[model samples]
Target: MTDMPLGAPGQRSVLRSLWQTQRVWLASATILAALAVFDPLQAAESAVFAVGALLNTAPFLILSIAIAAWAGATGADNLIAKAFSGTPLLMIGLGALAGGISPFCSCGVIPLIAALLAMGVPLSAVMAFWLASPIMDPSMFVLTAGVLDLEFAVAKTLAAIGLGLFGGTVVHLMMKGGAFADPLREGVGNGGCGGAKMRAPRPVVWRFWADADRRAKFGKTALSTTLFLAKWLMLAFVLESLMLAWIPAETITEMLGGDGLVPIATATLVGVPAYLNGYAALPLVGGLIEQGMAPGAGLAFLVAGGVTSIPAAMAVWALAKREVFAVYIGLSLSGAFASGLLFQLWTSMT
Candidate 1:
């Protein structure tokens, strides 16, 4: 039989599927092409800047994805469950701490939360973990340090824990008031990732590599995560380049430069509707900082974006009642504002 041509139906279907999954890459490429057409010199400079940013953060990105893959393959969620299976108060505290270190994005956390709720984990514990997980992670910390500074990264990590604690306490108090008695909306179990089920805990060493299925799982998870992050990082760097090339420094400074409460509040508000991933936000924030955006405002923006971004909120809404969803939003917004203000004060004093 003759060899089929590359343009056969099978190949066409495969290409279509690839494009659907990686539309961000296609979109970014289209935008870059347009930029090149409009201004070739600026487009070349922007491409260089974007590539440099990607190179600078590649190590941390790889490390984070590897860790996340290992955790997924080795059943890290079960470990989280065991750690939080103590007293309600202890669960809350430990859950908050776990949230800080867990390698999950906001949307990625929804499945875990659904699993925990289905398993009868305390709402307080779930609340703590849910509130904090999106804001920081081991990989996110390193990425933040690479893009911004160690101080900002450390402060953001601390803020994630603080916000989790605050959220836990509030949920606990509300539970006492007979609120959130039945927080899960219908079909929550059907929501989020279908494959997020917790497996039997295994050793975190070489066991994942030992089993063929586990190895495949790890590889698949890591590759998908790397590609996902790369897409966002590319877009973020391009936007950063545009901001640097076009937006006047004085404009950014005038809007978000001050240490005052107004500027901080504005940043927080802006972040709520802005659709920036945690990793992607770093480069944009770095650009803003270089243009004199206040450290406090930048911190606020990160917290707010992580907490209230559309994807995160949509996940919350899908799994919870309107009232519980409102509380989630309220807690996130309040925590973001408070953390930003405190960070500002600390930065000023030092």
Candidate 2:
């Protein structure tokens, strides 16, 4: 009936796309299968731990999902779009402040940055947003509180805003002195490479439930957010269980637990390379904390990894000139270390 023989092409394409998205979950399943074959008891234990952990996180997970969905349905990013049109100094500060709270993901930042640049927003303000956006968000705040604590979540939010201010100020001065002449790479603002998370601004409807379209949008956002968070978190919990079973606590303590700044520095460095998915890293760090890793090291690793993580780096590299990328990386590393040091001092004091 169809022109295509065997009908395999379309089916294969769908299957391949699914596999790419599900590979992490597949890996978790594979790990369980292997464990079951070799150590059935341990496999059961891991499964139990993962389920329990997920259950414990369910409240935070629900709240985060709801927040993300609400933002999408109500178009809260309209506020972010409006924040860019002002004096350069004011714009930069506003940009960083907005970025710290914005729900823009790594994928979203690409199009948002490109859009801002194309609209003639100054580089300093854009840089502030770029630097801080990945550091924190509303859903991230809720999840961090659930995984870590309320105090930690608040500290990270402050760190995100502070880093934005710090980076924005430096970049603003540099631009004044004739650095970063032509920051964008060729054809960056022309378009984006898909996976855009921020939609164009629309008027916020406080009662999204009243509108059928908004209700559908909310459901769609919730489902997608849930799946994305679920996969990474599932993989993270599995890895954490294995790390607990296999890796000795003494090793984690020796490497990342200490009074001086060495552990924080080490964490900052290590996070740039060793960090995995943002959601996935949470439980691993929590596991490390349980193993006596210094809280400061944990915070440093999170900030450094969140900012310079592969997705964030690749987006910058693909969109901006090399110098811009350099400054971004430099700021991220330094800011992460400073956040850790301050957090450590605070923890020690209190």
Candidate 3:
């Protein structure tokens, strides 16, 4: 019944819209170029960093689009909402499952979540899934496994699942009968193609064939999403390159040495202000591990870095209220710390 428009209002076509968003790309590129002024080597270094990141992150972004398309086409959107209305256990399970699949970094997930809400997802469930997905993704696990040990991977998965379920249950109970449904009813409405009407669910075989056809027809769109995420990852690489060129790994290690809670806490605190994509933070974290930080702690830092950005907080505040935003922040922080602490304990015990 909502009158949300089909596309962003105006005369712009899809290509034009893509062009419009290039402002962010330009700004990021400009920032990289400016860093080159510090030294001539920096410019080539920046370009190489950007290109390398784009190559590395391409698979992750493709995976993200595939998941997103599945979610959209399957209409799991409503099911996710209904799960929130059901038992806390159901919601928790849903959170854990989504955490394992979604490829969105916390930053990317924010906008998608806002859309999900408009489509009728439950607030608590959406929040829970948002918190968990960045930390618990299979991609993250694979990446972690490559840098860290198998034990570290196991511990991180358990922590992510536990925090996701625990946090979802607690937040749901505390905010019982709260107004998470309000935002979707008012102001800027949900997701792209928001106003597009939904079609009846197609049969399984039909959907299988249809998806194949659509992917063929819309390959460019899928690639756009991939390219978009890659572009952001490239920016992150540029930042990492700068850090590597100018900053000393020893300085960071000296500031917060290995085998303690201080490094974890410092990493979390540092993450609160800095906004890096989840996959993007990997290179930096890998660097940290090379510099003598524990793998578990580096994982904790990467998880925290993506989830607790100011932009994420502000998005919550803008859509919901200050109180709701506070709860979101508080729960996310607790989730981050809990995951970190649990992994540390698990590591020591096993």
In order of appearance, the predictions have TM-scores of 0.61, 0.61, 0.61
lDDT of 3 by residue, 206-318 (tens): 25335665545345434544554555555556665665566554454455448778777776666564435555556666677777776557756755655565334544654
What lDDT tens digits, residue by residue, belong to model 2 across residues 253-336? Answer: 456765578889998987875666567778878888887778888999889988987657766776678888999999999999
- Candidate 2, position 311, lDDT: 57
Pick by TM-score: 2 or 3, better one: 3
lDDT of 1 by residue, 1-350 (tens): 98779899988998999897777688778878998999999889979988997787666466656666776676564565566667878888888999999876664565566656644566788889898988999989999999999999999998899899999889989888877766776544423322223345556545768888888988887776566556766765676677657755345445666558998898887777553668777888888878777788899989987888655676677577888789998998889989999999999899
Query: TM-score of predicted model 2?
Result: 0.61
Mark the regions of model 1 whose C-alpha exceeds 4 Å error after superposition: 1-85, 190-254
- Cα shift from native, residue 184, model 1 (Å): 0.9
Q: What C-alpha lDDT, on a 0 to 100 scale, does residue 151 get in candidate 2?
A: 90
Model 1, position 210: C-alpha lDDT score: 81
* Collision pairs in model 1: none
